[model samples]
Target: MASVTYDRTSCVYPGAERPAVDELDLQVEDGEFLVLVGPSGCGKSTSLRMLAGLEDVTEGRILIGDRDVTGVPPKDRDIAMVFQNYALYPHMTVADNMGFALKIAGLNKSEISSRVHEAATLLDLEPYLDRKPKALSGGQRQRVAMGRAIVRQPQVFCMDEPLSNLDAKLRVQTRTQIAQLQRRLGVTTVYVTHDQVEAMTMGDRVCVLKDGLLMQVGKPRELYDRPSNVFVAGFIGSPAMNLFTLPVVDGGVAFGDVVHPVARDVLGRAGNSSVVLGVRPEDLELAEHGPAVEVDVVEELGADAYVYGRTKLGDGEHQITARVDGRRPPGKGEVLHVAPRAGHVHLFDVGTGERLGG
Candidate 1:
């Protein structure tokens, strides 16, 4: 296992007006599972490709365990990559596929067989050792791809959306398996995906990126609880946080008829008559007198329900979402009053979209 470092690393493709991965600086601890996540065209994949030595570092250096490898070739980087499509050779049996790297490295047949069997057992693919890739299910093929990397014992693992090919249910199951497998192997891993839930659940620390720039890196809960900006506030959560610009009045921002109190410093930082207020769906409650909203839809999820509504705040209408008890959700078109829980509101500068305070 080894630590990886990106020292102001950057990648600019030919003729591109801007860098695909801008001067990114990140440190991955030994044996840590770090996930790079963002929307499509956000440079997450380009960053991963840079680490794998597939893309050139245009402005800075990358280090693996104190060794500067910015100019190293892909095969010489001592890293294993699991592609999104599970690039397995169709004609090769599972055992052969897993041990192919070792065979190429000139390891004897006996040693390669031993290593292949060990990885298969760890991945629960021992029964399918003789089967070809065409005979395996998507999930099974993914595991075979994983076993291929495991058998090599590479210093770092680079997995680029390895679960994108699986069904939803299998994707969830395989993510759990991969997380556990990474923990057991203790290999430094960098995973790239567009799914925030997968990043939150599988990574020891998640890195959020946008437009080739790093947004924030933190534990899943930290990112969800205290986003650094409005973009992050709306991007990290399921159903997302409801954000709307409201007039600042009496040291607070208006929420319909009521003024929600905010820190004086936060209000001062706004430097404007209005500020954006963000509230998570689960952090809101039905109140007798609060923001009046016309319900558009209610999604009932067994123990909890989310109410999507539109409310006229200030001079314009804005959409709002709130979580309510699942047992009794208000009917469509029903008017409901909801308020964000005290001390749970997020304040952002309307002009800059930056967070004001905690």
Candidate 2:
């Protein structure tokens, strides 16, 4: 319903030396689902709080559609937020809790009832309208919280880790439901979570942040394929991208006795500077003859198996990790040859952590 914009917005916690969020600029399109993702203490939550008017903006402006709402009170901003904890009125019935805001805003009884029923039906909670929060399951309680926001039909919807309390199976189920609901309602939504998988699966666009600074913003596949830096590369992938700080010698890099060929274009940028090589576990496959990897453990995960091991490269260092595919995985203490898939390697400048070659 509305496009949200943060124009150089920033926030500093009282008495803190550094700002919690620094000059953060972002744009969320109308009816777009934008996700903010980062590790703990990465300021993702602070940025969301600022947008919700729960935190003071020390600089810049936040705009909803074309209106500057930096100085506006939260209640007047036409935005509804669903918190991680189900902040429901324990004493009120489900229907009353959903319609309480409308009642407070002086909507007529008929209108309130209609809106409540509409939201309840959409969330499949019509059967439990008279039930209290104490009687509902955790997932049902979360739905009630969502029902409260849906009835308002606000310009923007903000969710702060709204599914964190649910069990893993319930979380996955609710995730699909929420995504479908957002698309059906076509409401502009901003969601904040630390889970990369959640951000990747649910967002129309994802903003990756660290230390209060925006790192990269893009569609899920784009970030996965072409992360701007080492942090983004490692953080966005499951099992994380394996990063090796290796020396570039001649036109190739030495991984023990095996001197894998590097693209001339990639090597030209090295120029005696230390380079970082990043390879996803999926990218490195078992080779007939390649760099030797010292196997540590093998895990059989039904559909796939992970070969955990250390590399016999350079000083014969040991690092623990899992290799996919159990059928042909190397046994413990066995040395297996590994090679990166063509065009699947990621190279970065060690000093800057900037991507050099795809």
Q: Each candidate: what lDDT?
A: 0.93, 0.88
Model 1 lowest lDDT segment of ten: 349-358
Tens-digit lDDT track of model 1 for 121-188: 99999999999999999999999999999999999999999999999999999999999999999999
On TM-score, the leading prediction is 1
User: Each candidate's TM vs. the true structure?
Assistant: 0.98, 0.95
**What tens-digit string does per-residue lDDT give for candidate 2 at 40-122?**
88899998888889998999999999999999999889998899997999999999999998998999999999999999999
RMSD of 2: 1.7
How many Å off is the CA of 314 in candidate 1? 3.3
